[model samples]
Target: MSAASRAGSLPANLQGLWADGLNPPWSADYHININIQMNYWPAEVTALSELHDPFFRYIERLLPHAERTAKKAYGCRGAVAHYTTNPWGHTALDGRIVYGLWPDGLAWSALHFWERFDYTRNLGFLRDRAFPILKACAAFTLDYLVKHPRTGKLVSGPSNSPENTYIAPSGERGWIVMGAAMSQSMAFAILSRCEQAAALLGVEPELRARCREAIANLQRLEIGSDGRLKEWPEEFPEAEPGHRHISHLFGLHPGYEIDVDETPALAAAARKALDHRLAHGGGHTGWSAAWITLFWARLGEGERAWQFFEKLLRDSTESNLFDTHPSGGGPIFQIDGNFGGTAALAEMLLQSHAGRLRFLPALPKAWPSGRVRNLRARGGAGVDIEWKDGQAVSATLRPETTGTHRLIAPQGQRIARIEANGKSVAWKDEGVRLARGVVYRIAFQPAG
Candidate 1:
């Protein structure tokens, strides 16, 4: 996947570098709703940041076309891209309204920019490349959002949860509705990031203030009566109980709004939602199962994560190792699942999203001993870990910037020793502050 998305060229599409025939599946096009975005999920975490360049370039090229679509389609400011796009930068809505009318593509796609900046801590990239796109996305979201008549909270309307539908109480099957969980989550992600970027750059005071106020007024994720995260503003019956798309869990995985530690309640709701989906035969496809694997890893369910990972491999994989999406005729190749599985495996080993590097946060008992080398983390750090009996035994940390680094012992183990360039370094439960370009080695053992 990384090789397919070289810099100065188009990002990897559905077929990636290979197309089976002259008339490839979905024309091997860019699907912004999730497919295209999922293609790059492993780029930063798996130590392939350069592979993300083509996607960023693609987003940059999308600006002009997206701007026109935002105005012509919805008369909104800034920009909006719908569910699908192509190399020529077609930002217009395509296909049926159920799957095509979504206007949050630019917001979700722009998150790659923020993720890159967050991982690299590149001020120049954030300033010159990312913030502009983020700001534009925020601008469009602010203009697109409106106060819900009853709830009085800002909500996105006429947008479905990325191809999922619901049956209203009146027995009407509907795809478009107000305040879809995925839409709100995407809005919150983009707006909050924009505010952070503005604060970091010390520019766009008015835009920053608007974003802050809008965030305050945005509808929060709600827990349904069934203890699941509400997919829509109301408790409408799902058109398909086991729908393949679990867009409501977007905040839990790709977005950091929901966390197992910080927002335990929301995390629980998300877990219930996932359970409900899987109980109803969700994750029936390769990419969907791969996404579920990542979600389980994020929620720290190592066994469940491993189960889904295996399902992705056994049920959705071809003999040649290509991810296969079920079709009317037979299973067909799709590249997102391959990339998503790579990212999920990396997530199971090390996670750095929660303000600290968590070593093997979701190491499954099935894999009692393992080693991973050169897994990248956010905030410009790299990690290499070796573990036995599900406990981290030794690890190396390489920071590209000077700062106070925080490292969490895997599975509640204790750090027994720390060495920096063969010299003992003072440390505590949190971690040690280190200079850039220094190699830190840590040894861990089971606690008590």
Candidate 2:
């Protein structure tokens, strides 16, 4: 979330449609898939890496499915993808456009791409495709939010948490509520990204106050005594003891509302709940596994982080291609899996740990010699990185408006590296660099 972080942009070579190499994708295996709700990124990354290499072409064949899944202003409801013939927009769900409402996963893609832009600043890619995706998805939310006539709370019903199903305290037979915690997290992130994009684009605006107001009033589904994130605001819900989706964790990971720094209690609450889910055999599906992996990474649990990652790759996908059962197990794959794994793998290498970019937190001890081409992390002053020989050999850092970076490396090491006036300079272990936004090189040459 610093200018320097955003300034570097993604290396163009890595920016193009990656078909193979690190993003290994394979064939459709699932017998039934109602992927109309949203596309999956975790599956897509794994598949895309496979497709990135020159030898890969199978992932491309899956594109027709993704294209069919794309929707214009509205997020596709169930069965929306298969029936629509147009390039975008859902025409029907179960053969009727009964509800073309804004959905959460659609909101995530908008935020995800915007965050990616900081690393992959392919403006043309963002402008032509990513921006529209963000704009329309966000516009739908802006348009869709309707205030209740009496209580005046913004309501988004027909919404679902997708993890635990609740029981009404009154015993009226409960169901998923609209704008639940999961949905709010998704919506909040979408709005925040919209605001960020607007600031970046200049030229125009939105009612910022109202956006913030929504953030303020957005309800967080309460936590039970068991410490697990609840399904809804009502009584103890009849939960899925082994389900894969931990939809509510959005506030904890990608959206980043709860963290040890700002919201310790909520962060603890989230972790408590997430841990319970994992302990209770709440399996990690492709996308869910990716999120769980990310959460562990964010929390600085390197070994557990690696374990969750393994489950995501191995447990799901046949031959490491599709997600079918737990830990991304589905015969037919979801595109989100690809993006999720890429993110998890990348995060293990480096992280913007609570707005301070730290390198290599949760990498598996054995894996050696790998590189992440152009990943971005947010720090107010410097964009720092070091990669080579499966370790960060040297940190090439740039400062935004001349600032400092508290550089943390593998094994919990820390150093202060500075940058001034956009120029790379030699710096001491403690600190060195210009004050007005410069680039600096911090070397960690291996013993000869």
In TM-score terms, which candidate is top? 1
Q: Provide the overall lDDT of each model, using Cα atoms, as 2-decimal numbers.
A: 0.91, 0.51
C-alpha TM-scores of all predictions: 0.97, 0.66
Estimate, for each residue in 216-246, the C-alpha lDDT of model 2 and write its tens digit.
6655556767776665544355546455666
Q: State the lDDT of candidate 1 residue by residue for 1-448, as single tens digits.
A: 6578887888999978887889999999999999989999999998899999999999999999999988998999999998999989899988999998899888999999999998888989999999989988998999999999898999987798998989988898988888999999999999999999999999999999999999999998999999999998889989898999999999988988889889999999999999988899999999999999999999989999999999999999988899989999899899899999999999999888867788898999999998999998888888899988778899998989777767888767888888997789888766578778999999998877
With candidate 2 superimposed using the best TM-score fit, by how many Å does residue 266's alpha carbon deviate from the native? 2.0
Regions of model 2 farther than 4 Å from truth: 1-88, 91-102, 121-132, 146-153, 170-173, 220-222, 284-287, 320-339, 364-394, 398-411, 416-439, 443-448
Off by over 4 Å in 1: 428-431
Lowest summed-lDDT stretch of 10 residues in model 1? 427-436
Candidate 1 local lDDT, residue 308: 96
